[model samples]
Target: MRQAPSERGIDPHLHRDITELIEGLEFEHQEQERATAEVSWYKEHTLFFSLV
Candidate 1:
């Protein structure tokens, strides 16, 4: 009859603990992306190096 929030990309019960966890994960993911981008740029900027 009705689906839970988790099934729809949401979680109510987890709202208490999961909210904080997800927030941290979001931040971490963004940081990782930034780091990856920086590394990519360094590799590309190098004159004689290929890291990717």
Candidate 2:
């Protein structure tokens, strides 16, 4: 059986996995920001229209 790395070095598989996870998290963060901005805009418009 092949043993996995057990020392302080870059493993290709691990590096790839971590990179993918970071990218996924960044994409999710951007989506969340967009949704938040949309909601904020809607709320502001709704409030302004209600007062008019």
Candidate 3:
């Protein structure tokens, strides 16, 4: 019987899968950067105030 997609076997779908993985990682990185920038902006604009 033939093995089903062994680790040593060549897959025709590998290229598409790798491309998708890379794109997903890049998208996540962009989102992280945007979140970090927003947090930094909020921190910079914050001021300490005391009320009596």
The backbone clash count of each candidate, in order, is 1, 0, 0
lDDT of 3 at 36: 65
How do all models score by TM-score? 0.45, 0.58, 0.51
User: Alpha-carbon error at 52 in model 1, in Å?
Assistant: 33
Q: What 10-residue stretch in candidate 3 is worst by lDDT?
A: 43-52
- 22 in model 1: Cα distance from truth in Å? 0.5
Q: How high is the lDDT of residue 8 in model 3? A: 52
Higher-lDDT candidate of 1 and 3: 3
lDDT (CA) for every model shown?
A: 0.64, 0.66, 0.66
lDDT by residue (1-52, candidate 2, tens digit) is: 7656675578889899999999977976666666668765543224221121
Cα misplacement distance, residue 6 of candidate 1 (Å)? 12
Model 1 is weakest, by summed lDDT over 10 consecutive residues, at 43-52
lDDT of 3 by residue, 1-52 (tens): 6667775576659968988889977976666666668765544335434353
Task: Please identify model 2 stretches exceeding 4 Å from their true place.
Answer: 1-8, 40-52
User: Which 10 residues in a row give candidate 2 its minimum summed lDDT?
Assistant: 43-52
Per residue, candidate 1 scores C-alpha lDDT tens digits across 1-52 of 7888667865567676888789877976666667668765644234432253
